[model samples]
Target: MKEFVWAVSIICILLVFGVVLLKYLSENKKYKNSSYGKQSQKSFWKIISNQGARGEYRTSQIIDKAPFKNKMLFNCYIPNRSGDKTEIDMIMLCQKGIYVIENKNYSGWIFGNEKSKNWCETLKGKKYFFYNPIKQNRTTV
Candidate 1:
């Protein structure tokens, strides 16, 4: 009878420990998922604000304009400094050589010259300066 009692106590202790461990693991997973969800939402908004969809359309236009062999590919990736990082917009692997292109879409009255450090966009005569996409694309290429 005493041996049976000891076995029952051991089993009860093990059950309690298992329950605590399971709770901890579940809480950790919930926390991780919430943080990841927040990050993904932020990234999605950034993409929309940056007009990434318009850029893709512009890239398609550039691909159509370029003359290359039928087999040459467009939108091929070029490796950047990082192993997983790539500066991919439009690429054509042709008999000439590899060509890298970056596309930008701006929907306002462009109000700056080439000599200007910052280019301004005038929408209804309200001017706002934006980052120079030419410099950015040069670096991206």
Candidate 2:
């Protein structure tokens, strides 16, 4: 009878743990779907910095360490005919032609094709839309 009682206690404990885990996951999912998750992080630096900026910063850091650092420009802006400014992430002036480079920093499971106008990503049941960088960059290039 004592052994049976212990088994019952163990099962109850495991079931409680499982329930708690499920609740945590569900709460997390809800949080992600909420505006709190959708809202961009509010910080003094966050205002000036972002994922794309961070990615470009990382790229610059790498280029700064490279052997050919003198041939690249970072965050170069060009004015379009429409009086709008187009920001190029990185530009490599080569003998052949000026190469326009675009960078994107992303996490989670990315789901999109090369031709898709919009790319989608799923992170813990949340979905995000990002414009196709290739297509977007082609206009400036």
Candidate 3:
């Protein structure tokens, strides 16, 4: 009976894993066909797994729904004077001017100011620190 139970548990785990993989594949195919995915250089795995990538994709969708005519570039890399590259999440070009976007997807209460190098996210009872998005975008711009 114990052996049978173990086998059933293993089968159940495999089934759940299979379902998740299939869902991921389906979403990836759909994203690849979308205009936002075509413009984004980020891999499908990154889009699904990384919070920042997902945030950028969500921002792109919002931009697409806007009434104004604009061109959007995603996941852009610009060479800096220090020989390293600065990555910009999204750049929107319109009749007004070019706008640079730094996307941050964080839950809970976030605390930070423009001058702070790092920001704190209070989730549950814990605190998490992340680089300031404003500072990050300032370097990119």
Best by lDDT: 3
In model 1, what are the clashing residue pairs, if there are any? none
Model 2 per-residue lDDT tens digits across residues 13-105: 999999988986775564344332333243324422578755655565565555643466666689866778898778866566777888888
Tens digits of lDDT, candidate 3, 1-141 = 999999999999999999999999998887787667997777898887988788777778788888999998887899866779998878899999999998899999999999999999999999999999898888874
- Per-prediction CA RMSD (Å): 16.0, 12.0, 3.9
The model with the greater TM-score, 2 or 3, is: 3
lDDT of each: 0.56, 0.68, 0.87
Q: Put down candidate 1 lDDT per residue, 39-89, tens digits, no spaces.
A: 233342343355754465435444555666522243445655555455555
Ranking of models by lDDT: 3, 2, 1
- Return the lDDT, model 1, position 70: 27
Q: Is candidate 1 or candidate 3 better by TM-score?
A: 3
Q: TM per model?
A: 0.43, 0.55, 0.74
Residue 57 shift from truth in candidate 1, angstroms: 2.1
Candidate 2 clashing pairs, residues 3+ apart or interchain: none
Global local distance difference test of model 3: 0.87
lDDT for position 121 in model 3: 98
